[model samples]
Target: MPGRPHLIPGLSAVPPARRLGSSWSRGVVASAAACLVLAGCSSTITIDDHDLSDADRAACEALVADLPGTLAGKDRVGVEPADALGAAWGGRASYVLTCGVPEPEDYEPTAECSVIEGVGWYVPDDQLTDPAEDATPVALSRTPFVEVLVPAEHRTEGIDRALAELAPVLEEHLGEGLSCL
Candidate 1:
């Protein structure tokens, strides 16, 4: 039960893992002050850029162009590299989205898949961690897939809302040929 956040570069007291399908009442992080104690934690979010091919890069550009400024009621925070095909919202407990991800290796036809806005999302059952109340990571099941790392507090409701906003953009730009499994 380490209190420091694992994925990011600079965040203090943020949970190391999100316990999906569980409640955030496990003393993960209740207040913003506890997680946002670092100097630059509140200002930026760090995302490891993927080495995308030319086509993937083009697709990522299309997806990034239409990304909404706000998601799940949080304003978009800037990342270090301006050209990165990723977006982040909120402070310590933030929502992170990256376009042009590779398809899931463990994808199965029987796996849990959710369709939102005509987009098929491969729900990862084993890797899900609710770090807090709203942090749930959902993956899009398409070539040049998209990965959205949701905050621990927003829960499924927030994912629904975010998908509602992102679905159309993904469909129009990336095409909605993605299917389950």
Candidate 2:
């Protein structure tokens, strides 16, 4: 299969933004924003969980076991129908993380990956178009690829915090790799 254009072909710098003026892109951003507002202050956050293979499910369970109680200064919130491998943090679930995601078919080993503290991430420029509003998928560059859905409102700083907080868990459970510097 053809790799997604947004994927880095090799260890390279960040890719330029692709859907700057696309209407659907805008909708994605808007949807994420809406989720932030609606979920803010809610004790439990709703998660559209992933259906993972048995092996991936087991791996996800291992990865989520060590998730911190709070992230980016927001306390962890409850997830409804919470059997899936996932977690939400912040008053409005500014950050939502799900494990056991499949590696992007366009996975590029040479992509200019980001390393938070030490964990490497495959941040696809065009995140998956999730039906659930406010869910942006960021893949952990490891076996069984974990995906974290971060609110658009919490892009840089919030994202950094989420990665930093989760790095240890990932490394401990899934092993670690150096950033594609």
Candidate 3:
């Protein structure tokens, strides 16, 4: 008995503490390494800077400053050219918001629009009706126009959630007047 290994009826000779310490610690380390790798893989998103007048630039800056840290369950990511008038979120399926953009060429006084949280957003007719489109470009229907490009992968739920999350912020900075009529 003194020289023989101690064993339980249905368990290994290794103690629970020792087994957990070795395998659990390895698992934790592996998880941490994977997180680091994924973080490193996220590259900065590039967004083109829009030409803005002095007033529009200041307002856009303020709006950018107040943007939420996360949008539609995605963490905010850096935008390239550092001082571009926009912010982005996510990696592969990202959403980009650009401020001070020109009005859409086809926008008419009677164009269809959706109002979210006191903000009016206009999506082109084709994109609005088509379910196969990969991306939807939504433009704010007010001054200091803002545009958000939402990937279709997010679907209607993601788009609606993102717009709802952004609506209050847009209203605060862009004013509450002239929402979708």
Candidate 4:
């Protein structure tokens, strides 16, 4: 999880203890936005100059492994690959959008680790507070999935630029009629 959109700096999923402290803040944010599940997944993206320590790296690896079950099936739209699926733990991405189909009625519930950038400070394009009006994102699987961004002095900075660069080339391959997530 290097280049694409990640929860780089400002992006952090709250721990259970922390959640109790920000109950009001979380409610306000939850009601305002919709969730975006990355439809198709490519390799792990690398964007910034992250110097995670060994312990931190281990933590991140564990987090990614825990993500697949969270995105079971929110096939917004797209196709799956011809090669057979990989082992659940063998995959780089937690979930993949292999089943190309119409969007699901309800997205798979956002999990603790699935809240945002599994990386560090990445924010979902769909969740931008006041994003560009003509935000034609590089569709992940018909809908915008994740973007690994370059890090800026601030966690939220550099994201827009990453989106600009990423949205153009990350076209997904639509197969069958369901989702791989």
Candidate 5:
């Protein structure tokens, strides 16, 4: 009785505590919101199959097979209409990689590029600064041209990590002559 608050006929003697301006509570709410968003998305992602020559298809298949089971802290997930030329990771905000794709229309020799782990990537100018939510970077100076669709939510750093992780596999399967210089 001493430690407990007295209860009236229809209410407790003490009012419920408020968690206003609580950072911890705010963080919990944000995390739960993110989880809900992700949960609402289908685990299977759609990746269109590319038309490629036999040799290019072979290389893409090999590359897809060699891709890491995880990238950028996200586990690899199944892709719908499954094909060897494409693979994807994460849910909702997914990282999609497609091989045997044609070069970007805007791609030019003078375009800005980023070299990660000795692999060259053609990053758009906007992507370098403030990228839209669905900017993609394509591999440069590599055969069977590859590209990765990185959601803006992942930011530049996350895309960099994904490119770094895939560089070795790309080099091994696609062969390396990547030059941004």
Candidate 6:
């Protein structure tokens, strides 16, 4: 990194051949273009006809509303956005949600990985029922919720598609009495 220009965290350390104002914009553009990669990734994700009820969707939206506000605040570490840099609500049964980041288990030095996992149950909601406990501890579910890994710079785009794809699976996985909300 000495003789070369420095870049943003997710951008390439080496400068792009084209002119760019700053490393940030270059990285964002590069990553956004990676959305096209989703077509090829389509072969990897299995789709189904999971059926979710209206109540489930309602519960999910309500649950999501809380996360963005709750997560986007100054914590001890620092302020962070509720939604991952590129995250969306998807999956069946409303309980099935995915996030964009490397799954703690799948991280490796060789891979610029990101994880999108579905929580079968979110925290106290899945456990405590005093009607007033922090219901965030969710049980992890969904198949290898780590949807395809791409360059860290393009993770936002890849992750966005992953979340979009996961939404449909929610209904496909819903069961008779399963409560996701």
Using lDDT as the measure, the top candidate is 5
RMSD of each: 11.2, 8.3, 20.0, 18.4, 17.9, 18.2
TM-score pick, better of 4 and 6? 4
Error of 2 at 106 (Å): 3.7
Q: Give the alpha carbon lDDT tens digit for every residue of 106-167 in model 2.
A: 65666655554555666454442332323343445565667676655556445555666777
lDDT of 4 by residue, 49-154 (tens): 1344554344333333333332222111221222211112113322222111123333332412222222211223233333221111112232223322111121
Please provide, for model 1 over 1-181, each residue's C-alpha lDDT reduced to its tens digit, 9 standing for 90 to 100.
Answer: 3654443222112232332224222212223323345565456655557788888789888888788898868888886478778777776546677777666677666665555555666645554533353443344555577877655556544655676577767776674434563
Query: How high is the lDDT of residue 60 in model 4?
Result: 32
How far off is residue 162 in model 5, in Å? 0.9
TM-score attained by model 6 = 0.21
Badly placed stretches (over 4 Å) of model 4 are: 1-49, 70-72, 75-181
Compose the digit string of candidate 6's lDDT tens values, residues 23-69.
11211122222332454421111212123356544433343344331
Error of 3 at 23 (Å): 48
* lDDT score of residue 26 within candidate 2: 15
lDDT of each: 0.58, 0.56, 0.60, 0.25, 0.63, 0.27
Which 10-residue window in model 1 sums to the lowest lDDT?
A: 23-32
Cα lDDT of model 3 by residue, 64-100, tens digit: 8999999989998887668877887877425678878
TM-scores, all candidates, are 0.68, 0.65, 0.71, 0.22, 0.71, 0.21
Residue pairs in steric clash, candidate 3? none
Assess the local accuracy of residue 141 in candidate 1 as a C-alpha lDDT between 0 and 100.
51
By TM-score, how accurate is candidate 5? 0.71
**Local distance difference test, candidate 4:** 0.25
Per-residue lDDT tens digits for candidate 5, residues 1-181, read 6676444332213211210001001111122134325746566666666778988889999999889989989898887667647787787535778888777776776765555665677755544444434456678767788878766566544766787788889988995534554
**Candidate 6: Cα lDDT at 149:** 22
